[model samples]
Target: MTNSPKLAVRGLTKRFNDLEALSHIDTEIAAGEFISIVGPSGCGKTTFLRIVAGLEQASSGEIRLDGRPITKPGSDRGFVFQQDNLLPWRTILANAMIGPEIGGFGDKARVQATRQLLKLVGLEGFENYYPKQLSGGMRQRVNLARALAVDPEILLMDEPFSALDAQTREIMQTELMRIWEEGRKTVLFVTHQIDEAVYLSDRVFVFARRPGRLQEVIEINLPRPRSLAIKRTPEFVALVERIWNLIEYEVRQSVLEEMS
Candidate 1:
């Protein structure tokens, strides 16, 4: 962990043929900072994160990790996709150990690390269960554990809780906050949920549609260990309202442009 940003994006742009997914994206995710990107569908939030993870090539611009150019995928960044994407054949513990195994860690150390992560995510007793044996939320917990197995310096998540029930999503959000605070890991999260973004992020980046330009950045002044009670606070509501007002206009503009 460097004193500077663990991940930095400078004028990052991504285009697919004539469709520009991200344009001039500039953001810095400092070490141990929890940053969330919120935008409407097709706003290119996903594309932006994918570029950072080196899953998609950007048309121009550059990404750096601790001042070093990021040109390909490696263990420096861990990604948890929208779907849990667990392996059905493997047990939860086995799935969680995959990253460490692939990275050539010793068996005992990987098992110990995976067990600790699973415990942190509240799946301690279910380590032997397969993916199909677990619920959506449980599978997601496994997904999170797997990502942390290699101890990556950064975590890039793309709406990893969007598919769960409201209750499950709430639980997972709290769990995510716990995991983040415990490890102080740098995170770049993407989601369409305004409340989710506001609750989880130290700073929230809003994106405009079509080409996905930076709209506004909101600082979450809420205190740490934010529980559901904080979400009901006047301060939380105010933040959510402000973010919605900023993005609503952009979303309408995007819709109109598509129609036109």
Candidate 2:
């Protein structure tokens, strides 16, 4: 990690008219770090991510990348939504090239790079396939390749695996780890799955119920090059349990508040 943070969130807050979605979110993400945000439902986890992606506006405060204020979305940040959002008519290669195309830099070099990224994401042979022709997992792989096509500085993923089946989700988690290890891009992933968060994160940012606040940031002490087997280890299980306990408590508190 560098002496300076890769991304910084300061006093961030968001509101939807009468409802406040996020409250006073503050944190720093170092370069090449993988961070996960987890919290109870409606805790503004996705809202926070969208704000950082410049898809949603924050009611107050700011997000900075490399010391520059991030008031709008730019190529510096790549986002993977819960849904793959691939154009059904477009081939996988074409979909992956969407970023470069939109940026008006879709030259032969960009095409070669996109092909490389497609292979990196394990979609080399499927480049000609349409979205409907691929499996859910494969489609998501295309989504990832599309995001990486732009070579963004930071990757913002909002439950990118949440739509997949349990088995496919696990597979994608391992795939994501492999891709992340290769590039070590600064990533901010949001998920409701505690185990997923534990497995993929360098640190897990636990949030309180809505209006969400940063409750704690727990560092994962396990060694890297993590595999699915690590999820079975005592150390990994303990981390998952710890995060689960925190989120469970928040969920209970939210329920009690609603009941009251």
Candidate 3:
């Protein structure tokens, strides 16, 4: 019996000519885990996520799922981009339906699945709404629903809530936790907010800029079914402080490099 992470990335490196986006980065996300990748801007966190989603090819790396290599986009790995990226002309239901169509599920099954997903994401009555007609958070909810329609084993998200207001971001965080708890999907989320990372993650991976590498991996010791109220606890603050201190030096170095 082989015990392998659901997603394993080894010696991952990406270079754009003289620019190194990621380097010697290694990470393993187990099945059913919610892991957050956080770092300053330009740290290659999004690039790493794109590589795993097969949206972009890595310069060099080994990506594995259940111990098998991952070389292309597949339904098993679902992706939610920062922008909703909904079809400007399509209704919310139409947007959600497209997932199943591309994923190879037939119409009836796709329709049923999309409806259930719309409900799950709290957009039940907005099925007819278009992206132009929705708020940022609402659009992100549809973005999430579309990703879920295919029932992916692992979700790859890149700062899906960064655009919303403080209140909306908090609500979305709660919603995201609810989805993770109820749906039991493995997730690898990328974000720049340390608090957001600590609040929503099982483990938080902090990266360094300019040839990004994992600087630290902090395990969140907070209780499950985490609520907004958890943010006020002393334990949460202590963990956040510990994580912040670990990344502060790297972040300062990144800024200094840019200044020079």
Q: Against the true structure, what is each candidate's TM-score?
A: 0.94, 0.95, 0.94
- Sliding window of 10 residues with minimal summed lDDT for model 2: 246-255
lDDT score at residue 68, model 1, on the 0-100 scale:
89
Q: Give the residue spans of candidate 1 off by over 4 A.
A: 1-3, 252-260
Error of 1 at 174 (Å): 0.7
Error in Å for residue 123 of model 1:
0.8
Per-residue alpha-carbon lDDT of model 1 for 102-207, expressed as tens digits?
Answer: 8888489679878989999999899898899899999998999899988999999999999999999999999999899899998999987999999999999988
Ranking by lDDT: 2, 1, 3
lDDT of 3 by residue, 77-164 (tens): 8899888899999999999887788867857867987888889888889988889999999999999998888889989999999888
Q: Model 3 shows how many backbone clashes?
A: 0
Query: How large is the C-alpha RMSD of every model relative to the true structure?
Result: 2.1, 1.9, 1.9
lDDT of 1: 0.88
Tens digits of per-residue lDDT, candidate 2, 13-126, equal 998887888899888999999999998878988898888888888899998889988888889889999998999999999999999899998999999999999999888898
Order the candidate numbers by TM-score, best to worst. 2, 1, 3
CA deviation > 4 Å runs, candidate 2: 252-260
